[model samples]
Target: MSKIADNIESTPHSDLAKGDEHSVKTGRILVAIATYNEIENLPILVERLVDTLPEADLLVIDDGSPDGTGQWCEEHAKMNVRMHCLHRKGKPGLGSAIIAAMQYAIDNNYDVMVNLDADLSHPPEKIPELLEAWRLADSDSTVAIGSRYIHGGGISGWPLKRHFMSRAINMYTRWLLWLPMADCSGSFRAYPVNLLRKIDFDSFLSYGYSFFEEVLYHLKEQGASFVEVPFQFVERQYGSSKINMRKAIVAVWTIFRLGLKAWNPF
Candidate 1:
């Protein structure tokens, strides 16, 4: 984490507090992306993010991708002012990547922090819409999820079995946890940085795909308010998905364990 801290200090922050705004605006977004061996998709993702939301800063936490993702980010940082990347030692799970990114955002006093994919599956253009929804909902809305299960929201390029499996998982989670949000598995979402700090990140148990489910369940238990925004879920254009059967098994076990924990916090 010292490397991350040092990187933050090295970046120029003179313009961060300019234009008569002591507190940041809703548009002052921090996009946090977790990556592992995503070198092919990263540059394109960064470009789209910069073009779609020029004011937002991007933090890329790479889990020591052997494919030179860290080096690529370093090279890009020289020319891109709004981009920062953190290189962890090994392939830490998605939850750890997000936690690290959230810590960075909270430490730097960002107004809103977003989690998105590097595979361009999550459209950068919809980012403003998520922020707007959160703003309209006011400070009480702790999270804004980019949902695929709601009306006008659906997945693309998935086989019948895959789609069915995803929906089944979400249904099981909702039944067991009673989470109000529709798409607990979806990772693309925005959160108020301050509210994020309220949740005990250290107590978060899951480190894989199930982390999304556990976090949402915990937030709901904590009385955190949230809203769902419909998003078109596109299939990845590059690189294979990291999800596997072992991860799926772990997700089921994690849900059972964490569900009980959420129900009985004592």
Candidate 2:
């Protein structure tokens, strides 16, 4: 049971995650997804996840989405013990939501944390690939990145502008921050609980898309080892993207700020 607030809701799913069922006794894994108005995607996503990785625990951090996402999660959680939801006051930044997720995972005594998009773009089926990578990582490994720029990774259904923007942002960050890895701008990542506990998340720089890049840089700089898993990036099937010109501009500028901070950590 979760040691969180009273509003925290849970129930036993028809399928159990423990005992003589699963072939692998993967320790407590929390798939933390942050959501705003992911009504259309959440249901199907949860169903597939429950069927796919029944052993994984799910935590949904909803930012007061008026679309009844909170209520929907509450209802589904009633039947699914693995499902957990955190209701925030309003639409907080994605970075803040992720911070909340990290705290939740640590507080609840989970071993591994995979934070990804609530939309199906991140692919729930590939979750085991991530966990497998994490499992195989060296003792020093703390983060595993779902990279789209690697040899076996690519993108599908993205507009030319989106592709160009993604490539450009990564290129910009690479030259400025000296990141050798591809796809630092992406959100699909896994972190070990003990490793994440060592970082100072309060000092995270970006609150939007750049948050992905900033944290990547910070973790690498802190001597954390990482593994890259190639996965195709896909466009969201439902709802509009939240990124706007303002967020993009902020992301660009944050890259330089990150670079400067790296140069002089004072």
lDDT of 2 by residue, 1-266 (tens): 12222333333343323322333336678888889889999898888888888778888988888898889998988877778778877565887778778877676667788988988898888889988888887764558889899999999999899899999989988888878787878889888887766667767777677888887787777777778899987889998788899988988888888889877779
What TM-score would candidate 2 get against the native?
Answer: 0.89
Candidate 1 lDDT, 101-202, residue by residue in tens: 777877777878899988888998898888888888855546989999889898999999989889898988887787887898999999887677677776
Per-model TM against the reference: 0.90, 0.89
Q: Please, what is the whole-model Cα lDDT of each candidate in the order they appear?
A: 0.79, 0.79
Q: Which runs in model 1 stand beyond 4 Å of their true positions?
A: 1-27
**Residue 54, candidate 1: C-alpha displacement in angstroms:** 0.5
Candidate 2 CA-lDDT value:
0.79
> For every candidate structure, what is the RMSD over all alpha carbons to the true structure, in angstroms?
3.2, 4.0
Give the best candidate by TM-score: 1
